[model samples]
Target: MIGKWLDIGPTTQIEPGSARTLPVFGGEEIAVFHTVRGEFYALVNKCPHKAGPLSQGIIHGDSVTCPLHNWRISLRTGEALGEDKGCTPTIPLKIDGGRIFLLREAVVA
Candidate 1:
């Protein structure tokens, strides 16, 4: 029902070092992050450990620490950081004209 990319509004929607949730119609919920370094990334909202909501996790560098168990997940690669195991899926994302766009194929069918 949408185009090749999902336009998720302006970059200002998410503040630095924070994240927001985007519900996907045919896939898992996505967590969009605005790092303090002015970079943006999108990953599955679910944590690899215990399926915790990654959106509620604390953002530090390019990683988010799972609030459920302090499991750190890399925003860029979605891999668990440090000794943590497992990984969450990362949705391809980009920014243009101050708006965030997610790869349509990686998001929903």
Candidate 2:
């Protein structure tokens, strides 16, 4: 389950295969990605390893290759791929009426 949903902006604000980082309260940042398949995903902007900016990573399918170390991360689950270790935090997201909404609570375990 998720907590209060906050509207980020219209879906059009983020192009497919691209990402946008939004700074939230408490100095934390969230990375919102629009996949080529038109799906939206939200996760912590920082990578679990080295704290790299995931928003600048390359989007491939439902995953992103971290720019700092090429660590592939699942956009849907925020899990590190292959032999990589650790996982980033994922935020629940929903799209309605062409607008994007993010759950205020972190969905990570």
Candidate 3:
């Protein structure tokens, strides 16, 4: 399904090397990450392995380590890294004039 861009907030709202979880429609949440390299990524907040909170995980490079079971997931592609199986959904994001935007559609697994 086609998704519309929904403004989230200013890019400054999230500090570099940190993440924020925003509650979306259908009671699901999206994890928005600001990398130390000044890049932004969005992914489904829950880990595919054990529904761990990715937002609370440690951010290193472009991947986040799942808080529940140490599952590492890529922020760029939402794919589980190495030796791991399954993946979470990714949310397309955009930045305009220092503001962040997210697709309004529900994330698919």
lDDT of each: 0.92, 0.90, 0.90
Candidate 3 lDDT for residue 58: 94
TM-score per prediction, in order, is 0.94, 0.92, 0.92
- Roughly what TM-score does model 3 have, to 2 decimal places? 0.92
Write down the RMSD of all candidates, one decimal each. Answer: 2.0, 2.9, 2.7
Give me the runs in candidate 1 sitting further than 4 Å from their true place.
Answer: none
Q: Candidate 2, residues 1-109: lDDT per residue as tens digits?
A: 4447788899999999999999887788899999999999999998888889999999999999999999999998999999999799898999989999987655322
Best by TM-score: 1
Worst 10 residues of 1 by lDDT: 1-10
TM-score of 2: 0.92
Q: Give lDDT tens digits, candidate 1, residues 1-109.
A: 5588888899999999999998888757999999999999999999988999999999999999999999999999999989888989999999999999999888776
Query: By the TM-score metric, which is better: model 1 or model 3?
Result: 1
Ten-residue region with minimum lDDT total, candidate 3: 100-109
C-alpha lDDT of candidate 1 relative to the true structure: 0.92
Q: Which predicted model would earn the best lDDT?
A: 1
**What's the residue-level lDDT of 31 in candidate 3?**
94
